[model samples]
Target: MPAIPPRFSVTPEEIDRVVATFYASVREHPGLGPVFAAHVKDWPAHEVKIAAFWRNAILYERGYDGNPMAVHQEAGNVRPGMFDPWLGLFDSVLRHELAPETAAQWSALAHRIGRGLRYGLVEAATLPGGIPKLV
Candidate 1:
């Protein structure tokens, strides 16, 4: 049996470059920087982990092993509203770091994932009986 190939025409090195560049922007983003800063003390380690996650997601690699939804829920500070700015920043970085076609592909994937994460955060924060809290 042959192994599955990567979904997109991007290399591991490209993934690393994009991840590094995106997170550097993230660290300086007014809306996102503080949120990430509160949790990620080691930027380099976080970038490596996130790059592994993208590799797993896009390249069919088995290097990442973590639940993003669970981690966000556990953080208790990740808001649903943050997804927009986060995705916007991510799209910009993708556009700047990769070829236009590759950037579009990655952006589409990221937006889909972001929507799931945003929905999860919203559901996690809602009150019982399908009601959202007023707070």
Candidate 2:
């Protein structure tokens, strides 16, 4: 594989554009739209939060500062194993729109997100069964 490019920083405008384009596809994605629809009350607010998240994650400009997992968890949308589709949709968006290097970086981040969500889901699922105490 070719060397990944230097992290290409993103602007709010680019974040907005990318997020809008991404969600357009996401809204059509199987296993994604309904999941989000079941949780999000206002589309515009959700859009803004995601845009900010992208900006902060893809850029070091501190554009997005929301606690994404907390928001989703609070919304009762933290279905066990749901991270697969979440990461999948992001991967699809990166593949459809980003440069190869950019896609690679985004993929790396998405993997982390999926892993975190996976563990969180497992923990949440085990809660009713007496989660083991961490040493």
Candidate 3:
């Protein structure tokens, strides 16, 4: 893949834009909308938190301090399968709003995070159930 253009920068402002745009898209999604609505009562506050999360995640700003797994665990509506659609929307927004290399980089990071979150959710659910008996 080509390197990011010299003029292209992944600043906090860009992260904010990506998060805002992605969430706006999510709000309209049928599968994900109700899940978010059930958990997020105040969108403005949630947006700020999500923006900080991306800044901390992609930019390493050290601002986000919440436990994502705990939040996900509390969100009974969110299923492990939802990550695929969530990441799809995220990848779409990143590709549309960023340079090719920038999009690629962020998309990869999002996939990694999504996978980890999904795995954590599943593990939390299964626990000592021990992978079921292989009948």
What residue pairs clash in candidate 2, if any at all? none
| Candidate 2 residue runs with Cα over 4 Å from true position | 1-11, 128-135
Clash count of each predicted structure: 0, 0, 0
The digit string of per-residue lDDT tens for model 1 on 18-63 reads 9999998998998899999999999999999999999999998999
TM-score of each: 0.95, 0.76, 0.86
As a TM-score, model 3 comes out at: 0.86
- Badly placed stretches (over 4 Å) of model 3 are 1-9, 127-135
Poorest stretch of ten by lDDT in candidate 2: 2-11
lDDT of all predictions: 0.92, 0.69, 0.83
Best candidate according to lDDT: 1
- Please report how far candidate 3 places residue 75 from its true position, in Å: 1.3
Off by over 4 Å in 1: 128-130
> How far out, in Å, is residue 124 in model 3?
1.7
lDDT of 1: 0.92
Q: Write the per-residue lDDT of candidate 2 for residues 1-135, one digit (tens) a residue.
A: 654432574456756766777777777877778877777778777788887776666665455667765766566656756677777777777777777777777789769876876676567556556774342
Per-residue alpha-carbon lDDT of model 3 for 1-135, expressed as tens digits?
653333234888888888889888989999998899888898878888998987777666667879998899887766789999999999999999899999998898889989999988777667376572222
